[model samples]
Target chain A: MKSLTKNDLTLLVAVAFLTLFAPFILNPFPEGSAMAQFNAGYPDLMQRFVIFGIFAIGFNILFGLTGYLSFGHAAFLGVGSYAAVWMFKLLSMNVIPAIILSVIVAGLFSLLIGFVSLRRSGIYFSILTLAFAQMMFALAYSVLTPITGGETGLQLALDDPRILGSSQTPEGNIPVPGLFGMEMRDSFDLELGSWVFTFNIGYYFCALVLIASFYLAIRIFRSPFGMMLRAVKSNQQRMNYTGLNTRPYTLAAFVISGMYAGLAGGLMASMDPLAGAERMQWTASGEVVLMTILGGAGTLIGPVLGAGFIKYFENIFSKINATILHEWFAFLPDGLEDFIVAILYPFIGKGWHLTLGILFMMVVIFLPGGLVEGGQRIRSWLQARKSKNGRPNGTTEPAE
Target chain B: MDAIILQILNGLDKGSAYALIALGLTLIFGTLGVVNFAHGALFMIGAFCAVTLSRILTLSHTVIDETKTDFLGNPLKVDVPYVHDIFGIAAGNAIIDWAVPLAILFAIPVMILVGVVMERGLIKHFYKRPHADQILVTFGLAIVLQEVIKYFYGANPIPTPAPAAFKGSFDFGAAIGFDPNLIIYPYWRIIYFLFATLIIGGVFAFLQFTTFGMVVRAGMADRETVGLLGINIDKRFTIMFGIAAAVAGLAGVMYTPINSPNYHMGMDFLVLSFVVVVVGGMGSLPGAVLAGFLLGVLESFASMREVIDIIPGINQIIIYLVAIIILLTRPRGLMGRKGVMED
Candidate 1:
């Protein structure tokens, strides 16, 4: 491995600082505050933020680098979840073995799928991956019911033989996922004045893995192999003419990314310990793509941001109902309030997907570079205005 | 032998749908060079058109009847459709009864308009963009359309029944000089099959015999050359998109009686149709139709009780399995031309 550049070190530091202080940053509202509904500092959402961040980061390595959009990525994620659940069923409640097994299983699955799917590129590649995922989903839903537990998904059984540890905890209940001794669900709540912040063990564990994965991604982005992958993306015909075998490089990238997805899936199971066939669905795969693109595909931090952004809206925005809309519009006259509620009703709660779709379309049409580019545009616009007013801000351009 | 024929018939019925959707998909791809993820949504809208028309025909107002009494001994309140007053009871009843077929007429204009608006409003801008961008944008559009439908109609599947005349199954065994009760098929499925055939034939004939289609075909072959001939090909391509949308919509409209109409039905068919298009060779009309029927029949065969006993869950994944094999071995699909999207 090459030594980290100054910019890379700065990114590493920034990511560490941000993730370390995420609880405080995410929870801006005070306790018992009216705006508390907007708070995203909870462990479940935070864990999802990092877990999906890892998934998107892995996806970027394949899609952002090689330009091969595998719509079957969720199959690997699903495979990983099933593997992890099986690990829990057979071995112990410890997440280490489960995560390890997940990465291995997903890697093998992607290798098989990619070896065949990569024979074609462009839309064909996308369709092939989609078909494979759908096949896996069908299997998980029906034929592989014993392994995947069918529709209800794979769950940890109370009577299963655990050679490494007891099937049930000492309390005669199902064991929670843990790191050796520390429970994943364990949290330390700190209260100062009117505000309370929770530091969760699971969130931190996921954050650590995400940071490591992000760092590894940065290295890959700057590596010679990464350059080769980019070359394949830019002009495969030229690469072929140059006598370079692009298949192995692409296959390797696919496997690596699949493992990352598996890692994310394993972490998800560690947090929740359930794996459903829905995890392997094409929609789940599309969600990861949306995350990568929305955050700004081909960029390092963009996928993470996109993942966080979507998860936030999916969880928080979907919680808003008619009553909340009515309350927000209560200051208006009765007729106007009713009108406003009616207008706002469809874009919230169950209509969150509609909002997401519109947002995705707008992003694709106007901001191809994604949210990252949107951020850059805003910053540059602000800088231009500041310069025009004869006061220059010393802030340099942000890292890609 | 009869059982084999029955499965083949089943396959043909299934294939008709696949062929229709794939044909439309190929038309759009050939003319516009856009992979429309929203094509299925167009079909769904077409089906909903039938539902909408039926709802309109059945639009009723409450009428209080002094001669009739309710269970509680109060004056009876009866709902009477406005169509009954306008067209008379028998004609109104007929109209409502044949709403699914009548939806074809309603869907054609609506689908074309929707297609035109979709092309003008969104897809036109994406002509110069990469296929990925096109896919993403259209996928977004599809989700939006589906969600909008869900918002209005709710998430449940709405059963749009065929006319009373087509309710019974045809005894194919007796028709084929076999045992009387050996083989049977639903009348609606047969109608759906025939309707699909008509649409496919019509689309092919229009493209083959018409000047507009000739120009469109020429433009599809080489857009720059067609433009150099001082022709406005873009307008015709826009029309082609509308026609494609209509084809898909018509397919969806007729499909309602077979499977019931739901918001997500379009999405369910979308992936399969895309596979059909790819397997048929992306921009080839005949390829799309052939592959659609081929896969449809294969799917039916895979779903046979004997086949399922041999390979559990083969029914659910047979199409995708066939697609992967064909794609890996013959990258251009069954009838894919040499240069169409091979890159």
Candidate 2:
């Protein structure tokens, strides 16, 4: 792969800045506007978007680079969350210690899980990971309820001593995660005409971290280790015959990805101050898989796009109701209006799952390479059409 | 000794479900090379068959009882169904009593039709896809089926009680020369165990003794070779899928009384059944049956208060823990054949 050009790096930095400011940009519309409904500017959901994006990116590192599809990756995320929450409870309200502890715990957990699960390859590996995940989920829900908080989940309380920060108030307010004296949620609002914008400190913090993660991922993708991982994906037997210990490399990648998940998990609890067992469910693990595949696995930017797309759709779809459907069909005739609304009824709110299911099926069937591939195909088609229209000579002239 | 026997009987009742579902899963995997993740959904559908049948059997119409007087001093009336009048009290009561048993007849064709439709519509297209793709599609199908059921059933566990004849516990100790209460087991549970044994035996016999069975085994071993011999292997595989569906349906039908069927019941059992399949070694028939019973007994042991206190949640994770240990020690699984998922 070519090294990142200066222009490309600049573009990336600019994009990162924009993402950090996305909440402000998105909040311009009135609260009641349709676009406002799609605003991912909220603290909780924005944190989730970046956190999940990070999670998927890490998953893509293992799966995309090494071609090892892990069905149990969510277990690491769950474990990380639990670890971070425990840190908050036992130590301090400061997120640094929580995040660091979470990453270390998650890394250790993955080392053990990956060591055993990686013994087999392909479907066996997938099944093994799945078994471990289910076991963890069950354990988390039942036996470890005291530690994991069972179905109710673990949360921070006022009783927790703030060794690094002020103790949370008795009103049960969420303590804004801070570094030094700078609080993450502190933001400034700007108004212009009918539009409003809010620039949040947490958004910048998340963006800075995301950019750092992306840069590290890019570096890894270009490194010798990445080449070795690709070699493992392409022909493991060939690599083994060439005198390489593939186990350590895979284990290293697993741990790195696991730490990323821990970071995401820590961020999740830092923003919300709560960690639920439901977050560790197999379904959550499956969701990350869907995001990776949907965005185009093996591409650096794809998982982020996929995460954003799914989160966006999830927000928009769930907010839709029968009233919205009725309004959408208002322009039609009396009989046709009701018919159209009825036909569209099951794809909204609680029925949004139906839409997601259909989208997943369509993507798998038509665009196995996912949204990135779809975009490339469309671009190439447009280019072909343009060239065909421009060519008038008997001999086709190629652009240099 | 009596406690041991009672626990053994309890284990068998649970074992019956695991065995039947594992049998179905192994059948499909053995023949189709496709993991039917929606097998649990089919089981849930079968349970609903009992619920639907009970609802149908008890349908009533009202008639006025003109001879009775109300608290307001007006003539009172009672409404009754025409079936009650025509069948008379004893026969009508018998019809209601036999609702669950009669549901088997209703479930078989319906379950088979569902199986056929699922195979022909969704799964047939996925036969050539990768295992991951197949898993994803089937997993999606399972979710969709479960959600649809939830939408209709309102997410509550609906009971499907067995007939009055099978309602009470049996004093097995009396026959075995022990205290009656010490060795007692539910009559319905024992019936379920027997029914599962018969179905398992029947399935095994059919596969072992018949020409169809011979062909299916041959196809499972090598489909191309079986096809070269002019056998329609795909048809056999499709039939095997149907058989698997029926087995899961039967398991659910019998399991309704033990644990009331809910929309999410299939999901709850799915992971455990997959563990059973894996422990038995993927696509191994006898291996599946053996592992199912072994895991079932182990789960019962883990559920004991003493064991649970020692290792909390062991009951929930016992099977999976065993599976991981087995896979690590033996990558091909306990009985997995060479070259299966080797690629």
Candidate 3:
């Protein structure tokens, strides 16, 4: 704990601050305001931001540090969710056991997958993991219907035998997940003037876990183990010639990331109580990968930012309908407004994926280091301008 | 025995599609040394090309039908296709029916254009990048391409039927001395198999016999040497990219009859095709084809009633399971060459 550097501590504190105040921070617009549609302070989206943040952070530990991209990480996430839900159904409504079981199960699953997949490097590794995830998805969606609940998804049943707790609440509803006596869905709303801030028990609980995960990730980044991972990424052949077996290190990273995904999935189930097979699909895996890369893969805070950015935009963009577009563009002449709306329609609302895709490609092409690199570039450019004004062409390298 | 024969026959058309896509993937990987993930999008685009052509052929204007009245007693209006005015009713209807086949001609040029532009515009910049970057960039491009398709064509699957002549099933069991009606195979599937063979044979011949192909093959072996010999290998490789894209597009175009063309069909086939490539050997063209068909047949056999009764979900994981085993044991795949993507 004492090994934490000042920068790491500052970064941790910043993230902790951001997550704690997310309800207020996310809901900048007041209730019924014209811009209120853009507010993402709701419980569902906020829960997702932190949960997916955890997923991406863990992913970065493997991909960013070790440079091993696993396209099957979602399989672990799905397994985690299923395990948690099963724990809820079979044993109790208490979430601690479920979360622990999910992490452990996911870790084991990832270890098995990583052991085989780590045998190959590069694209082969990616494909192997993808194949495994897809196989898991296919099975969960079909033959494992009894266990997974097939396309309808695994949901808490009223008839479920709660070995440790009552099957149903006092109100006759299927008992919701909780920590001790506090239910996950319970929330407190703070109304200041016209604004409403939802302080949810689930979001706060998830936030604490995310902070712990982020702290652990930061520690990992600064540790010798992380340096070894970076070594594996830079050149595995050199590491081998240096007599260090790189496979174990990679497998460990894969498993750790898988556990993180599992943790996120567990949290997701704890909040929602429904585990769906769709969460394990290749596209879901791709979403995490996109989040990690889009945030800046190797950077500590990047994945969290990326996750928040994507989830927030996804919510905001989906809310932008034609009616909203008309309202926004009311100032323009009719024909021109229609023309602009037509031009912009496909990139917003249901077409947010198109925008995301374009943005992803642009980031990959121009800013390989992701938003982190963009920030660094802008800072450097500003510094370069300052130096140029003072020193008169004394800057050595060109600002890129 | 008939069931086995039927499954194998059923496997052939899908195997053909896999082989075609894998074949194109190998060509791009071998020639340009780029992992083209958007190759599946090219296939989807090809299927949509057939859909587009069919839609264009059937494009119509409303004409009044006084003989048929609506419930409200207004004259019923019937759509009269522009093709009917140009080529007469029977001919136009036939053209529309054969749109899936005629799309081969229509798609070839369009696909080649798309391929060339993709290579020249996007892939050209990625030549010196790492394989991961290539994959990521191509994947992003794929998403963009797929979403664009979804925008133009709604999310539903558009069924593009094969020509009426090839509509019915052929009694393969009866012809081959098995029980009659035991092995009824779709004519279009047989035609698809034949067409796939023709394309595969044509590709092999093009690479084997032609001077341009020879240079391209040499470039695949050693680009520096070919360039040193004053042959413009890059140009040939670019053309090879176009060829690969066209091949995938043609596969998609032909596959419309087997399965309806949806925006996501490419992504569905892509993961399997990638497995085919890895199992076949990354850069080995024949390996891709061999593995494609082998896995396809294997998949069918696994899906058999007896097999599923025993293994439960063997059919779902068979290809991936085989891929994992083969990848672990044979590392370079079935017929992979050394020094190709080994790093």
Give the poorly placed runs of model 2, Cα more than 4 Å off. Answer: A5-18, A24-29, A166-176, A392-400, B59-93
- Ordered by DockQ, highest first, the candidates read 1, 3, 2
lDDT of 3 at B15: 91
Between candidates 1 and 3, name the one with more favorable DockQ.
Answer: 1
Report the lDDT tens digits of candidate 1 across residue range A281-364. Answer: 999999999999999999988999999999999999999999988888889999999998999899999999999999999999
Most lDDT-accurate candidate: 3
Q: Of 1 and 3, which scores higher on lDDT?
A: 3
lDDT at A2 for candidate 3?
72
Better of 2 and 3 by DockQ: 3
DockQ of each: 0.89, 0.54, 0.83
- Score candidate 2 by TM-score against the native: 0.92
Per-residue C-alpha lDDT of model 1 across residues B59-82, encoded as one tens digit per residue: 999999889998999999999999
Report lDDT (Cα) of residue B4, candidate 3: 90
**Model 1's CAPRI class?**
high
Better of 2 and 3 by TM-score: 3
Error of 3 at A284 (Å): 0.7
Which residue pairs in candidate 1 collide?
Answer: none
Give one digit per residue, the lDDT tens place, for model 2 in A1-400. Answer: 2588675576467658657767775565676676566666676567667878889889989988888888888888888888888877777666788888888988999999989888888777887888888888988888788888888898776766766555675566746566666776677766666566666666666677777787788878878999999999889999899998899988888888888887788777766667887877777888898898888888878888788778877876789888887877789998999999888877778777667767776777678788989998999999888877888463657989
Return the TM-score for candidate 3, rounded to 2 decimals. Answer: 0.98
Error of 1 at A248 (Å): 1.6
